[model samples]
Target: MTQKTFLVTGAAGFIGYHTSERLLARGDKVVGLDNLNSYYDVRLKESRLARLQQHENFRFIKCDLADKAGMEQVFRQHQFDVVINLAAQAGVRYSLTNPHAYTDSNVTGFLNVLEGVRHSGVPHLVFASTSSIYGANTKQPFSETQNVDHPLTLYAATKKANEVMAHSYAHLFDFAVTGLRFFTVYGPWGRPDMALFLFTKGILEGKPIDVFNHGDMVRDFTYVDDIVTGVVAAADNPPEGDKNWDGDEPNPATSYAKYRVFNIGNNKPVKLMEFIEAIEESVGKKAIKNLMPIQPGDVPSTCADVSALEKAVGFKPDTSVKVGVENFVRWYREYYRV
Candidate 1:
């Protein structure tokens, strides 16, 4: 493929940072955008941004997706080949105390991106969605074909809203828009609040780690690299309007428009205790466990049905939990000098 330009929102974020790196590595011009919010450590965001800055083809823009004027200005300035919206207020539990943040970033910010894409004539728009949208769902492996009408948390609700909002724009404006529902993504440079980061930090420092759901949870823990692979593949090939899509029995995953949603996750599900053990073995330390009940808006389990992704992208996220945990552990130790 020839050189292309991509506008990656939340460029300083974990998945966003990795996605920008992948695009730059392929000799693509990447205009990265981020608000540099203190949702987590601004220093961590800066560290990731600094590394991306080393690439000559990579340009950084510090702008929030919610800033309508700033976002409009960005679209006006750049002639992007593809626009990937990964910026959002991320966190399941944090949504409880900070509801406004979810609306401001996930809902309002996402709308701004849609408007920008609609007007800018960007051919393709790929944005991040989450498996948390599968709330009140007891299914073993969540499928994209299932109805996601009952989101348990504000964060999940906002993301579900994004999927709905994107579909409308795709139908009305006629452009390819893909939404990826990422399962428990974890790897190097992951968010601090994630289970792996917290468990690794607590184990290395001899502190008690809070194991929610009393260590009986299940997650299809996907490695970040695998997630990025699926993301790029989806971005590369934009889906077209499904001509045979039936209105009688509508498929939730695809629409009559050039829009779709896919689950990007390791098909293998690992128990919470097993995931913790992997981290412990990697760190060579045991965690002082404070097993607690499943918190509000927390699901007991999550497993992704990635068959749609495989058929569409010709790939599946097959990274092993052991290898992924070890990678994160090594990065944590080296980055923090633990």
Candidate 2:
């Protein structure tokens, strides 16, 4: 394989850091960009970056995606073969109170990324979209072909906006663009805000864990390693314009332009209570469950149809929830000295 120089936004982020590590492991040069905002524990972000810094092939940039001038300068400085965008104001419930953050990061920040990729002549731009965009759809397994016009939260809306924005850029600029709709991702070095981390911490501390929707929620919990595998594969194989694409019966997942969307998920949906049980088993402690009603902007379930990703990249996420949760618990214990 030819060595390629890649730029990954949110390199300090969970998925971004893992993706960069994968690229570097393959002897590719990676320039990781992140603002390291206070959305979560900044120490965790720094720790992730520290691990990346140990690699000679890795470079770090302290920049936000919304910073147009800074983004332009970075693009001018580096000749990236591919740009994988994973940075965003993430969280469905958080979007309810802090709505502007989503617009700034997901919407405007994404615009900056698109402009950077466009001007830099980057061949492939693989960005992170969310399964949350499948909001309000009662489909058993969420597919990229389904209509995602009815997003329940502001965060999902912004991500949905990103899909259309990238498509427009692909049509006008003729660049290869692929959007990946990620399911619930968890693993070692996972985000503290995610359920696995929260449940683990709460269980170990003998604190009550918030069981949302009366513990009736279902999620396609994907491991970060599997997510990174799909991401790298997509980056390596950029989408080509679909020649058989028809305008009359246009598909939401593909187009006549060089743009496509694929769902990267574990395909298996596990119940919320079952996930908590896995955590409890891993921690050797049962959680004090505080059953609560479903919060606003929250969905009852999320299951992905990853057939398109498998067809495109010859891979799909197959990690089981039990194994994935155990991995997270192991990491959490070591990281927090529990």
Candidate 3:
């Protein structure tokens, strides 16, 4: 396979930074795009960007996906062979307070991406979906075949909508699109709003860590390295249209169009208390747990069924939560001089 030029949206973000760095290490040219919104600490995002700037193959542009003209210009100027859309208004709880962010970034912004791919003749478009889309479903391990019609939060809804939107473009324009449903991703350089980062920070500061769902929750936390590996593999192996796909019994995982969805997770759901213990072990400090009820739009648990991803890519996420947490804590301590 030819090493193609890749465009990774949200390249300043945790997952995006890792993905872009890996691509650069492989000698692939990468055009990274980000708006650098103040949803979290801009300093952290800048810090991430600083690391990527060291790589010779990485070229970054400050732009939002919602900017149709800017996105169109990028598509027109660069002959992007693959586009990995990771930019979005992330967080289930944040959706409750800021619904417009989802609409503008996830919905409107995503539409612009589709337009770019449709016009630019890009072969594959791999975008980030979320496990939160499995909302209101009581399934043990969420499968790609399951119907994701019931989303509890605007964030989940936007992701679910992205899958549908991508499918439509694939059918209409013959573009290869794959939507990756990432389970709770964590590691060094992870978002501050995420659990592992928040818990580690609070524990180090001798502050109380908010334990949602009264510490009864579980998360299939995938490490950042594993996620980028899966993502790059998916980007290289674009989905072909299911020739034998039956319209009567539609399969959500694969379609008659060049579209598919796969869950990228550890496939091992760890309890919230266990996760906290892992952090405590890594940091050598016990967290002051402030037990609280489940917040609005927050799911109690998430476990991904990554068999399909394994079958497609011949790989699965194998990073243990303990190791992942330890790495984060180590980086945190060094980064903050704690």
Candidate 4:
């Protein structure tokens, strides 16, 4: 493999931090960008940045992706061989309460990323999408070929829109754009808003953990390291225009235009209660359960069909939930000195 410089947006984020660190470890130069928004905990973001700053080849830009001019400047200054965009206003329930945040980050910010890549002559652009796009679809083991037209929340809508936008750009500019639809990713240094973190915190504090959908929910609980693995593989293996693709029978997830989407998940959907049990085992404490109705904009379950990703990358995410939860709990205890 050739050594190259990568521009990774959302470097302070869970997946982004791990991706950047992995690249740095391999002797590649990384330019990381993050606004460090207080969506969850700024302290956690700062801690992620602190570790990346220790690497001599890593440089960080304190800016939001919505700042079009600033984004363009970053692109102009660095000739990034690959651009991985993970920055977005994330969270499903948060999208219901604060819809504008999703618009600002997922929509406007993503546009800025597209603009930067468009003008900067970046070869391959890999960005994050989510499984939430499979909204209201009761299908098991969701595939990339499925229609993702009906989105339940603004966040999912924006991500689906991004897929369309990326396809258009690829067709017009010959740019390679690959979108990875991630599942419920969790691990060490994970986001505080995610289920694993929330459960751990609640259990540790003797508080009741809300079991949504009356414990009927399931998730393809992917490990963060596993997420990073798929992301790096996608960036390295950019898709070429599908010459065999015909407009007569259009495929939503692939195009004749150098664009494609893949599901980066564990391909295993675990029940919510089972996930809670894993957390309990990790902490050696049982949770006070508060069974509740499913929140608006939340899906009952998500399972990924990762055959496309496996074929393209020659790897798959195989981390078991038990090992994953154990890793996370260890980190949480060390980080918080609990």
Candidate 5:
């Protein structure tokens, strides 16, 4: 692939930082953008940004996605070949308390991204979606073709809105758009709020770790590198409009326009208790488990059908939970000096 200038939103974020790093490593010019909000740890976000700054080809832009003028200015200034949007108000439980944040960032902010890309004529717009959109559905290994009309949480709803929003823009503006539904992404420099980070911290600190759903939950824990691989591949291969797409028998994953959505995840689903055990082994400490009932707006399981992604990109996330957990543990120890 030829070197291309790219714009990566949420550059300070976990997945965003990793994706930007990969692009920079491959001799691509990257303009990394993030508001660096205190949604989690601002320090962690800053650290990620600092690393990206070390690359001469990478430029950091501290801008909020919701700022229409700022976003428009960014598009006007930079000639980005591809735009990867990973910025959003993340966390399902947090969405329950802070509902408006979801709309502000995921809905309105995503609209700004779409509009910017539309006007700038960016060939491909690849954005992050989530498996949470598969809420209330009992289907094993959620597929892109399934109807995601019933999102349990506001966050999921916002992401579902983003998918439709991108589809509309692709149809009206004639641009390629790919939405990646990431599943339980975790690895080095992972979010502190996520299960792996939280579990490691709590285990090392001798604190009781909360295990929801009575430790019966299952997640298709995808490694960040694997997720990034799928993301970059999707960016490299822009979707052509589905020629066989029928209006009467509509497929939710693809459209007649240049739009598509794929589930990029480890096809293997690991049990919650097994994941906790891996953390315990990695940290060499036992966790005092506070098994609790499944919280509202939370699902018992999430398994992604990655066939579409593999067929498209010739790659699939196959990282084992044991190895991924060990990598995270090593990073946690060194980063926090634990």
Candidate 6:
């Protein structure tokens, strides 16, 4: 593969940090951008950015995705071979209460990113989508071709918006744009609001952890490293215009233009209890569970059909839950000195 300069949005974020590191490791120039919002703990984001700063090929810029002028200026100054956008306001349950935040970051911020790519003439743009867009579709294993018209939460709606928005740009600007619907990703330096992080913290602190839906939920929990690998592979192989795409019976995953969507997931759904058990085994302690009804803006199950991803990128996420949880627990212990 040829080396090139890449622009990574949300470089201080969990997935963004990992993605930028992978690009730099492969002898690519990386310019990382982030707003460093206090949505979670800013300290955690800072720590992740600190590690990336150590890389000679990595450069950091503190900028919000919603800042139109700043975004345009950056694009004008730097010529990016590919734009990997991983920044957004993330959180499903939180969106229920703070709905405006979702639109501000996911919608407005995303528009800024699209405009930057458009004006800069970036050939390929790979962005982060979510499996939550499956919404009310009661399919066993969600595929990219499934209808995602019914989104259960504001966060899901915003992500679905991004997919369509990018598709339009791909058609009009004639740029190769790919959207990745990432499943439940967890690993070292993971987000604090994610299930594994909360569960591990509660168990270690001897506090009762809330088990929603009476522990009936199932998820395709993907490891972060595996997700990063899949992301890099997708970035390297931008989607070309599908010559065989039929307009009469359209496929939601791909268009006649240089646009496509793929799911990057573990493919194996793990029960809520089974996932908790893995964390328990890693921590050597049982969690104090408070079983409760399912909260609003949440689903009971989610699985991914990553066949399209494999066909396009020649790779799929295969990390087991046991191994992923162990890695997180080990990292958590060291990071917090638990």
Q: List pairs with backbone clashes in candidate 5.
A: none
Give every collision pair in model 4.
none
Q: Where does candidate 2 stray beyond 4 Å?
A: none
Model 2 global lDDT (CA atoms, 0 to 1) = 0.93
lDDT of 5 at 178: 98
Error of 2 at 252 (Å): 0.4
Compose the digit string of candidate 2's lDDT tens values, residues 48-68.
999999999999999989998
Q: How many residue pairs clash (N, CA or C atoms closer than 3 angstroms) in each of the candidate models, in the order given?
A: 0, 0, 0, 0, 0, 0
Q: Select the stronger candidate by lDDT from 2 and 6.
A: 6
Top candidate on lDDT is 5
lDDT string, candidate 5, 1-338, tens digits: 68899999999999999999999999999999999999898999999999999999999998999999999999999999999999999999999999999999999999999999989989999999999999899988899999899999999999999999999999999999999999999999999999999999999999999999899999999999999999999999999999999999999999999999999999999999999999999999999999999999999999999999999998767678899999999999999998
* Model 5 misplaced stretches (Cα beyond 4 Å): none
Q: Deviation in angstroms for 100 in model 6?
A: 1.5
Q: RMSD for all candidates, in order, please.
A: 0.6, 0.7, 0.8, 0.8, 0.6, 0.7
Give the alpha-carbon lDDT of every model.
0.94, 0.93, 0.93, 0.92, 0.95, 0.94
Each prediction's TM-score versus the true structure: 0.99, 0.99, 0.99, 0.99, 0.99, 0.99
Q: Candidate 1 or 4, higher TM-score?
A: 1
**What shift in Å separates residue 84 of candidate 2 from its native position after superposition?**
0.2
Writing each residue's lDDT as its tens digit, candidate 4 over 20-98 gives 9999998899999999999988999999999999999999999988888888889888999999999999999898889
> Candidate 4: misplaced stretches above 4 Å?
none
lDDT of 6 by residue, 196-218 (tens): 99999999999999999999999
Q: Residue 142 lDDT in model 3?
A: 94
